[model samples]
Target: METTDLSTLPVPLHPGLPMLGNTLAFLRNPLGTLHTLQRQHERLVHLRIGGRHQYLVLRPEDVKHVIQENHRNYGRSPAFEILKIFLGNGLLTSDGDFWRRQRRLAQPAFHRQRLAALTTTMIAETANWIVELKQQRSKQPVNMSQAFMDVTMRIVCKTLFGSDTTGKLDGLSAALDDLNYLANKKMLSPLRFPYSWPTPDNVRSKRARTQVDTFIYGVIEQRRQRDEDKDDLLGMLLSAEDEDTGEKMSDQQLRDECVTIFSAGHETTAVSMAWTIYLLSQHPDVLMRLQAESRTVLGDAVTPSPDLFRSLTYTLQVVQESLRLYPPAWIMSRRAHNPDSIGPYTIPAGDTALISPYLLHRDPTNWPNPDRFDPDRFVPGGPKDQLHSYAYLPFGGGPRLCIGNQFALMEMQILLAMLVRSFELKATPNQRIIPKPLITLRPNQSIWIGLS
Candidate 1:
């Protein structure tokens, strides 16, 4: 690939309707639009969104350049600015030194060993869900989407706040749903009005944000009153000190981190697990193999420990493949702070760069039969092993990679193992499964599965 002087040559542009640019097309079908661009432009594609210049980077090397190798030249995109209203400059939305500091402080909470110890909590919560699911098996079709959200939310609450406050947090799933809907709406709108306006969507978003803030703040107050440190994430955050300044996080900072973790931790895992189950339900052979692996490794054990869960290799592969097809964080955007050179194109400063795992994972050149659901691609020495490191980034890459990647993986493994062994999941007939690319890739319609 020959390098191109962007100053002299014009980059390939994806033409769109006047004024609206690609905004309407993008809103109508985000994943499809990106896929089309990737196929047409091959490497770098420029898009004009409401007069704003956006670059869609499709190649792995380009993705690596922006996210890892040359990450310093890039920062979180303005697209994520809308999320600051809810995330409040937390790890997800914060950039520069503050992000680094927060990442370091919160890293200990999600360490592998700490996550290993949380296996029991995962099993216990999953067991409770199994019981509830069993009771409702004979009722109307199960909304596995909402059900997984409930399970993952409970697990996150327990793991983050400890078991004492787990059940105390209700309406979290609904509140988060509202937030996701509002955030995505604002992100895709060509003419986004200030959030301060009294629009109906803004009103709903504020109410939803207030509900979440009220609950999290209440938790912080209760923990503060205790005057004792516990072993949970909240406890760690309360006692965590900045390595440089030796200062602790304030109430608002703590609240922000908690809310960020609360939203990111649960929403992604739930969607991933829900989509994984849905995929398994569609592929009976894969489901059979997964069940066999579960039974063989678990051997009638009611609950799975970390070691036993690790032995379910095929189950983990299914999770990986599901994420490839339906990555929770489907699209990521970054802003170039300085002029940067990718393989053959120069990205000018101030240009927005968009990277989508949804498109990258499905690229025909990197993945053969990309749309097929095949867990074997993730096995040792499998096809995915041959691909570039950045080519398979469901959790993203570089310095800002998802902090809870390990935690999310372990939680999904435990839930899938327990649920698959305990019940038979079948998708409701006549329901079309559409991946809605919002903050996370979710089912556009309700995913109804009959649990037998």
Candidate 2:
């Protein structure tokens, strides 16, 4: 039951243009706008966005309040309905007992030991990308964003579905383009025909959805009938049975989980890797340290193994710093199920409160010289060790911390080590590139890179 009480909304609403509120400014510069408003008022600032109530919570303690300490009173905001367009009722979008059960069933596949075994698969796919990049054999700039997206999508497909999506990449790419466009547009504009209506946008989304469904469902059906090796995440999901009732996931549930894993596992990792490499291009000193560490750890080896991953501390730090500066999962919105108090502020029930990793990670109070790209902040007992736990959650926090967090970090480490050790990468000179904040933070323009 959502509380409609307005008494708890004590903060003054941030000013915006008439009728539209701050939506236009937000559309132009989301990060700066929110941070500026919060600074002008209290740490918790209210704003009317798309005709809805949203309180921007900037305090680390307030973040701890919303996502950790008093989490039960909060739930996935209505904003998640957009994600469900692709993810369905999987762990990313589901709530309560359903999400709990899905998490339990899907948890075993992501165990450290199980994921360690997939390191080989991750390296192989990355090596394949290297081959593809080399075959192009040109020093001219290529779109590194799309390149990372392709390689990461291939890696996730192989590890999660037990096969590489090389052949289906073109089709999958086109389908995702359509879906992403619709989802982004709807999120920004907020007025569109019901998905069921025969609007042109709805039809395009449906067609794309069907194309992806065919591929995922076909893979699931084929695997179900075949008696060959079942050693991947999909296999685990299929075989997993609830301890309470011994019930296995239905085909529908499997499809939903597979899509969830694919979307979550693929695009976010792609964006992280792209940003990591691009940031390295700009910071040669940091890149030099990373290259030194990569060469030392990966001497005479074309690919890194799980054993060497621990020794590449600087490489890991570079990745960590990249996430802090340009976190792919930058902001998340949660709705209150009941009236709640966040630090000194009150959150009325049913109102949306946004806890942004981007905001918290950039707060000077939480991080000294917050905007600077300083990997040492993450160093052991070096600044990060002193901040509150919720102050730096690139993968979120609390019970809903991303299950694939380790998986993504390990994947990025292997690829970064391989790339730096093997090739010299230069960001295309003289082009403006920025982070475009969407469901994930992505390069606003095509980030071009050259390889020697």
Candidate 3:
């Protein structure tokens, strides 16, 4: 790919307008655009968008090269600048040695032991939410999507932050929405305006950032002044010292990580559960089987042990399948620091690679009848065992893979199991459901449903 043949051969470009490239289509319906490209091009499709060299990597091995094999040579894309407004330089946006040190310091918080404790919190909080869900029952339609978002936020705040956002939910939700809009616009728009330009969008984004900063910084200050054993994520993050320097995270770093974790932890799991619920409602056979598994394995249980949670194979399969179809964090981008060979194409220095889980997961080559909702593919020794390592990446791959993978999965399993077991939720008739691709993929507007 990168040998002398590279100079003679050129990367194929996805067609676009003069100077604008695929910005319009990519921004209009990024998932749809990429999915269409996945069908037309081979693995790596090149595009020049507003003077930016963008490569849409479609195959697993090529994605592996960017995010794993030669990962050190690739850093997070500059498009993350928008997220930096609200997320700061947290794990999701940061790169290089700084990211490595931060990763090392934060790794312990998600260890198996810590995750087990978090599981208890997840189970308890989910149980409480289930009771509340039941209590709120009425003839009025319930938007389970928002309900999932609210419940997961509470669980994440309580389990990770050692506090909850009971009254702050509405404020936080609005702030998150505004920030999401700003981030989305920043990523897709042709003009790259400085966030400090004081335009309407900039002003709104700044206000949103201020609200988020105030909330997370307040949480960090509260934890710092506390004397209790701070093993909870927020506590551990506060007390964590770099093994190399014996220095703890700065207030900014802590706030960034807190916001990153909270934004990711609650939102990803909530959307995954929402999609899972929507899928289950559409597939009665899968729903019946999932409910049966829940009743058989977790009958009236407040908290199942890790081993017990793992025993629900079908339930776990359902969650995995749902994630495959509707990954929370749908797209990841990396910029090459040097010339690199990925399959047949050479990634030029400074070229940005877009790896989409949404695209890869739906490839018929990897998944037969890809769009069909089938959980059996994920059975322990089933079809999933044979897929390429990078083919099914709901939580992504490589060292920078999501640190909260286990926390997110466990929360999704527990909540989905409990929600489906003693309850019946049906998607409202004649409703349009589309995956709204923002910071994470979620249902457009509210997913109207009847919960009984």
Clashing residue pairs in candidate 2 (N, C-alpha, C atoms within 3 angstroms)? none
State each model's CA lDDT, in order: 0.85, 0.83, 0.84
How much is 83 displaced in model 1, in angstroms? Answer: 0.4
Candidate 3 off by > 4 Å: 1-8, 302-307
Q: Give the TM-scores of the predictions, in the order they appear.
A: 0.95, 0.95, 0.95
Q: In candidate 2, what are the lDDT values of residues 1-452, reduced to their tens digit?
A: 88665545586678899998988888889988867875686578888887878898877877887888888888998878887886688988988789889889889988999888888898888887887888885858877888888888888888988776689978986787677778877777657667789988888889999998999899988898894467788888888889899998999999989887878788888888888888888888888888888888778766656688789888888888999998888889989998887655687888999888988888877788887988888787788888888888899988898999999999988888888887787877787777788888888877778887
Residue-by-residue lDDT tens digits, candidate 1, 1-452: 99855554446788899887888888777888887887788788889875678888888988998899989889988877889986788889999988888888888878888787777888888988898898878857899888988898889898888845545556766887789888878877767888889999989999999988888888889889988687778888888888888988889889889888888888888888889988988999999999988878877666656688888889899999999999988888899998777765677889988899999999999999999999999998989999999999999999989998888888898899898888877877888898987788988876888888
What's the true lDDT of residue 437 in model 2?
Answer: 87
**Can you tell me which runs of candidate 1 are displaced by over 4 Å?**
1-8
Model 3 steric clash pairs: none
Q: Give residue 450's error in model 1 in angstroms.
A: 1.7
For candidate 2, the clash count comes to 0
lDDT of 1: 0.85
lDDT of 2: 0.83
Ranking by lDDT: 1, 3, 2
